[model samples]
Target: MRDKETRLKRRMEPALTPWSGTTEATDWSLPEDLLQQASRRLSILCVVAAVLWGIGLFIGNSFPPRFAGLNGHPYPWPGNLVGGLAITAAVAMWLYIRLGHARPATLDVGLAFLVVNAFAIGLLDEWAPREVRNRSVSWIAVVILTCAMIAPSTPRKTLFAALVAASMDPIGALIAHLRGVAVPAAAETFIQYWPNYAAAFLAVVPSQVLQRLGRQISRVRDAGSYQLVQRLGGGGMGEVWRAEHRLLARPAAVKIVRPEVLGAASESDVRLITQRFMREAQATAVLGSPHTINVYDFGVTKEGAFYYVMELLVGRDLVSLVRVFCPLPANRAVYLLRQACHSLAEAHSRNLVHRDIKPANIYVCRMGLDYDFIKVLDFGLVKFGDRASTRQNLMTADHVTSGTPAYMAPEIILGNVETDPRADVYALGCVAYWMLTGQLVFQAETPMKMFVEHLHGTPVPPSQRTELPIPRDLEAVVMRCLEKDPQKRPDAAELFQMSCQCKASVPWDHEAAREWWALHLSEFTRGLTLAMPAAPAVSSSPVTR
Candidate 1:
């Protein structure tokens, strides 16, 4: 009952607070990808605006009224100045995009140009003919409002720019009046500026409000669906929660990560991590193997937190199982390793390398009638091959240490991100050794020492490391996987086949598994006191003898 109430509170929890800070644009305020796309589109718009400005200038000067007294003038100084500002802005934006500084400074440059253009045009209106001057402030306000709407900036920034631009027209008119220019009557001047301000305010307010509303709806919708039931573990990157879908009552595990956890990382680094994370989740979701954990959904929160939900398994991981039960018999190890191999085979076929595979990541679950069902977990450190073009490689580039030191393949430790499925094969061998001998293939006091051993030390065979009798075939397969040279390690498919051929004195059949679980989980089995049904025999058994 207490747990249910906690879940209810989590469900009722509001969406995370919208990011708060000064209204001024910052790299963290919006998604980096959105900024880049908006920057490119805005750059194009600036170039187009410049082109239109030049054409309008040419036509106005070629005709009479607008440029009557300015016939054969070298250049319309006021108009040319505004035009030059537009062209300069266009060039700067183009360069900014080409140089890849768009996210941090793109909106800044755009807003600067809009404000400057408004003031420049307003100053030009001071010398226009009475007919043009009468409506000049209104025209300038429209231009400023238009530019703000199309800028790469956020709604707040756009609205701020619109307000400032609109006010400039009145300020410019006041300056002209003070400078002894042939200004309009005070009432007329007031009427001209007030209407322009009103129109600009109306134009900007609705668009910004609608934008804010849309974002709010999206945030509420995202946070409304799932309720966290219990806290799972977390690491440097993210936290995991045991959660349930409100509508379906389906249990799941959700992993959540904040963009701020990246600490001092630049926008590009954060973007790369987000991209890699999504790609990893998508790839894992499609593995199609029953042994692979399933992903249900994934998305980012309004507050820049990333999350994904996966099927929740209620069972001990191989690490805990081995720690409590000591070294597993050769038959049980064969049973578990073959299932893991099936999962890895599917991942390998999809051109994914699960860079971090260890005992903790391989789960042993009791599923319906089947006990000791294997579910491979945690593909967060997967590396996509060149063939997997849909996913971009991390910009930090894979030279850095990424996987757990104990189980990481030697090739990965040596900074080879391009290492193939064989790297995973090696890690699987380490896991197999740990399962068979109740210890890692190599033991060291420090990570560096372990890395050194994995890089240069020869691993003792599983059979030699333990008194328990491991099948010769299974030991050979495990030893081959621990080979330092990746080329020497058998691929996942071959390992699967070899595990199928391994012979053991006592095969861990379904009945044996059921009996073992009944003893280990006495309280769980109390509701099933009826006589157990006869179990089916293994056909083309993965474990022999």
Candidate 2:
């Protein structure tokens, strides 16, 4: 048995192995799917344009110049050339899309499309009277705008195409005049088309630049001491990544507020978010519960994005566990909730109320020989008490609703200013119900309805909601936590004791957790070994508090 456990630990140790020394962010393109989708859409548009041009050519050939209404200056050479070029360009685009060559080919095809169209329009402009030359430039400008709208080109490509297309008429007119054709002077042609050129650039540049910047930021790997390995998840405010520390060689998870979120916000809003981020990091770092996530490091990046590092966990959160194997056994639910209570009890004693306590924020990790170890996460929404400061109170005083609606307590939903540890107690009750019943205490379609139910509706007992036999003692404890009034709901310390008192057959203790993980999560434990040629000496940098 001793040898077996030793071999098990060896296999799992690779999962804890950290990647050494940080590297700078490398340039990478958008994913293949996005590039291919944009390319295919542009190629299809080219095919449609080619077919339309062929039909127009057939109609022109079936009649005389005067009867065809070509302004009595029918030039089949220019029309045939432009139409044939469109068809050839379509074929090239089709090949580009089929072969999946997106980068260089996209620019090449865009340039060809712009130059050929401009040259064709310039040739036809030679047939128009001098007074109509400026009018013809307007029509040609419209063509360029329409093509840009259909192409899958980036801002850089669009800008290049716009500049090349803008210059073509002036250059084409000069060449035509040199060949003895009656055309406007190069300077005059450019002056007339300048407005159109400016308009084309204005229409596409801003949106494209914003899009390109957003994509580039999302793919960034290096952010200070931690190097991002893979994106874990993201929300409206920020994103979380599985990362590793450089010198310490410790596996960690990093959460970062998207840089653009602050860059695009008003100054006051930016200040609020930054303050909130720092407060959260400090608050979480001060928490001393073994059930709370260990904060490793925290700081602002060089690019002005706020980020913090936490110990990376191997097991899934309660949300995932309930989703995959719910209708959890009664004792198992009690075991997990008791650990969560211990975390919240510590936070409450420190005058911090964790506004968000949903199942998703409560992770069940395999900590060494201990299985079913709960680690409460995301203290970013921790609300300080009135004793802190008027400024601190004003920050969250707007009564910004700050928790999952499904798990929110009545006081939070009612916008009460004095929300306390009781609010967390209510949320914990909702989590317990979800674990034992696989459904929320109250089911509603919209978030508003869920909030309304929390504010006014009574919660159904877990035993009545599901077929699973929830023990009477545990059921009583869950019901007590779900009480609407803050005065009635039990505090975390009391709930922790009550959960311990519940006499139910526990099936998710340390032994069961190890056995279950050996059967179901062995692969997750045996992680890939990240190469670290020369592991650096661990630094003694102090953690933020």
Top lDDT model: 2
> Where in model 2 is the C-alpha error above 4 Å?
1-171, 174-222, 262-265, 390-399, 525-545
Which stretches of candidate 1 lie above 4 Å from their native place? Answer: 1-224, 387-391, 395-398, 523-545
User: Model 1, range 1-545, lDDT digits (tens) per residue?
Assistant: 45643543353233223333222332235444555666776677677767876775786557656555642332465567666776676677667667777764676677776777667656656554354444644666677666655543555566677667666665666666676555777667667678556655665664465445434344334534767655557765776666667778566677766555644245555555665456556667767899998877776675545577787665678777889889998898998999999999988887788887888788887655678899887777777766444234542443468778999888888886476788899989989999999988889999999999999998887778899987778888888888888888889998899899998888888888778878885433344322221122111111001
Number of the predicted model whose TM-score against the real structure is largest: 2
How well is each residue in 408-461 modelled by candidate 2, as lDDT tens digits?
998888876767788999999999999999899998999999988988898888
Each prediction's TM-score versus the true structure: 0.57, 0.63
Residue 396, model 1, lDDT: 41
Clashing pairs in 1: none
Clashes of each: 0, 0
lDDT against true structure, model 1: 0.68
